[model samples]
Target chain A: MPKGKDTALMSWKEVPFGCYILESGNSVKFKTGDWRSFRPVLDKEKCIKCGQCYIMCPDMSYNQDEEGYYIVDLTYCKGCGICASVCPKGAITMVVEEV
Target chain B: MLKELAKFKGFSAKNLPKEEPFAPGHRACQGCGEVLALRLALKALGMNVIAVSATGCMEIISSPFPYTSWRVPWIHIAFENAAAVASGVEAALKVLKRKGRFPKNRRVDVVVFAGDGGTGDIGLQALSGALERGHDFVYICLDNEAYMNTGVQRSGCTPYGAMTTTSPPGKKSFGQMTWKKNVPAIAAAHGIPYVATATPAFFLDLMNKVKKAALVNGPAYVHVYAPCPTGWGSKGEDSIRLAKLAVETRIFPLYEVIEGKYYITRKITKPKPVEEYLKLQRRFRHLTEEHIREIQQRVDAEYERLLRLAECL
Candidate 1:
């Protein structure tokens, strides 16, 4: 079996006592980007990098690069378009996610 | 011994904290305001805190048995006793500090995050008891207005004329028969040190109120307006927009009560029509003109009543 797979279906002895999650912030392993029909594309030239996208995002998918540009980590972005809408510079555009 | 809290000047849009205490990944719908409020609350409290959440959308979405999104110390408790558990935690921490078991110099905030059902319905008794007994904790009720985790059933905090699974509007019934319970007012009535109302749309206001809640020496209650897009039949991107509209329309006013004195936080001079706010969410789509008028009247009366309270201060 794959390591760290869901142990709910496993035998009682194999499961951890009291359904305890030993590791913290382990939800990063699960990608939720597939759920969105649209994806936000950032315009580097137009982006002033106010960090609105980073602060307002429901999913903590946006990270600041070396240039301080708020970039989305697509693995965890749910594509809510909150950043696109809240951006004062209107630097983010949501395009149809290509399957 | 009561320690003096460090004064926070305030947070402007430009200078908000960069720390993201609530991690992302397990599952919350696109543009969930509940998670947004939760994240802002944790940011305000910072890392020196222990959060206790009830069985609701946040607890279910963030922790899925094997995974967790919390970076700080967290405990998941039953649906009704979040406040009860939080009080016990506060008492234990006090004892531990007194006995020299825990560090006396370090002050850790104990916070409770619960939904409307957990705070206004099932958990009201325990919350009241904690408030009356003066527990040094902050209880944030993420009011999505329904039992959203269990597929949007109506709760006591659900507003009138809004449709939910159990309170669907039909030929026989007109959505929820009762008005949204004023839980913040109820908390303030306990004569607690701090009580406030906030929404995710106003990030600065929310963070300030939450931080103040932690600063107070006694129990503090912050009722946050948590918008549920999937449950309310609204577009995913419209969640934040809807939250803003709800406040502008006077449906959810932002204010804080400190020791029985009311202070309006974001005062709206020219309020929008309640119908404008209602039209965005399909849950209120079924309301007729009469229903809209009724809702508007109620909103005006409530706002006026709050204005009267704040006027004295």
Candidate 2:
């Protein structure tokens, strides 16, 4: 588990139990990329730049470069293969990660 | 086919908002479908909304002590009163807005996120009251089928013939004897403006329904089909596959009701047998061939009934 924001001033043991609000942007510190066992590699040659991969990625890990094609951010990608499944051109393939 | 698929053509990561209302790092199980649905729904709802979460998996996991995954203003209510709390929030916000306490240009959406136990059984009365009173809020029931947080006890939404802690199968009886409750249909029966069924397997559809539900004037209900790998005894990685199978098999049809009018979003052209779905979970592992056939018949009948409802409008 990632350390929450402002742990010095507030702690789980100290806070009163009930309904209370937390500051925004606390969830960004947690990275889910380690959950990936299979990573998706994009073949630019077969890619149509149709943006289907970008749309279907649940984690929003796809980033569009200056050339207008999308790139996957491996830091947060969970390797769900949704992009590859939804890709009409079959440009993306899921490959097993070498241990 | 091209024209039919064109509706989703331009959607890209660039189009999505930069803000992350519900953050990661809370203690949700890996590949948890309920968390996935919550993420998509919160993404669609954006930063200007307030959420009331009922006591369940999400509530327990997201807000454990000092750490919280929510970025927006969220309230953790009881297991059966999220709708009531949200209604109160909406009413208070309305009066505050009238008194010029808030900016005239701003609109704060009141939303509820409850599990199947909270919505289908414990929270039904409060939910019905909120909807009947015409509260301007979006109520989302992330149905994971049973009381997952409380050691997998069977709830009202638990489907027939599935084994749970309280509904184990034996020589005299099969698991949970009743069918899954149709919470969305009950919501529509209240004449709410929007009532939709969504699954995390279809991210875009779930996002669209959440957005629509947020914008409705009266009460809106979005019943999301969230599969629980822990309780269902399935591989964590196969969570999305299990959800997709549920949709493809037409066992949990993806549809919506707009002011009593039904619309089937993703039509199952050639529905697969329910056994394909049942085989994915260990809860149904004890089911015999005869039991599977019975489940298939039940699914087919339900699908036909949904089709008829869609045709009525």
Candidate 3:
């Protein structure tokens, strides 16, 4: 088992006694994760990256990695479709992730 | 103490209940003015009334299947039929009141809430029908200036040269070309018992108008200028301040049309320039110098017209 999962399981015995707690346990679930995630899939074929998508996205979900290529962070993406629509090159498509 | 003396002399503050009729957990965009309007309207009306909301942001957010943000008995009808629905409810309540079928012969005032698109555009016919038919109900148009729920599309209430999804400000175009439809004027033409324009920024004025409209025997129309933060690219909390500026600028005059007479309530001693109101929202960002002059001219013309009406009465 993973270290976090093992910690969670071991903490159950201490929960009833109210004496022990695991600091490394994955007990906290972020409330915002339930909201829909929109990942921008770049179509390199239509590759005139004008950076409009990067500028328009309110969440700052997209950034160029060290390789100088745009990468999207899906964790905080609200799927507002603003980035895709603002892309002048139409190089980005918003994809919904399965729950 | 002076504080104790002040309290003794009818200066004690009453605590308003924190229980919101429009509860949290419903999905409305951050800083939605329509929700604020509904909440305030409900607060004024209290718990004894039933609300009929049109198919807009308020309805979509408040009523979803078995879940509801509304603590009061609320109904969401078709987009254009909120007034008509409220009329029916009022009629039914009237009949029940006559028959003494209601609990303790209580009277339920029917209140209809709708957006600008629902009122000035799609729902105008139904609203006219209700008004002409002389229903005992209050109809409120929470005018946020556009079809915000449908992704900030331009509606008839959208001002001239204001950008939206439908009226994008492009190199060749100056956003929306048409002026906002004068909905209160049209409602006034119906010669209803009461018709008024209000804003949430003036809470007491809004509450008093609502109370007067509620007590009126026949149909009453209240058009509230609700600011949309997300749609207008403005700060959410600036809604009330913008509403106040709208009134101060004379873009939305706080006035009442009562029984064929016009009364200008809360008139500004020195009206501010329309630019003060227009400059705050990004919707009017495309407005040129010529456009601003035209808007100022129109605002002055409308203010003069209203003043003439007040003088006539």
* Top TM-score hit: 1
Sort by TM-score, top down from the best: 1, 2, 3
What lDDT would candidate 2 get against the real structure? 0.84
Tens digits of per-residue lDDT for model 2, B101-204: 98877988999999999999999999999999999999999999999999999999999899999999999879999999989888999987889999988877
Show the lowest summed lDDT stretch of 10 residues, model 1 chain B.
Answer: B1-10
Count of clashing pairs, candidate 3: 0
Judging by TM-score, tell me the better candidate of 2 and 3.
2
lDDT tens readout by residue for model 3, B34-127: 6656766666677778889899888776654334566677777889889889989988887886788877456567899999999999999999
How far in Å is the alpha carbon of B53 misplaced in model 3? Answer: 0.9
Residue B133's lDDT within candidate 2 is: 98
lDDT of 3 by residue, A1-99 (tens): 568656553344445343322221111221122455555688877856555444334333456677555666665455556556556677878687666
As a TM-score, model 2 comes out at 0.84
Using lDDT as the measure, the top candidate is: 1
Query: What's model 3's TM-score?
Result: 0.72
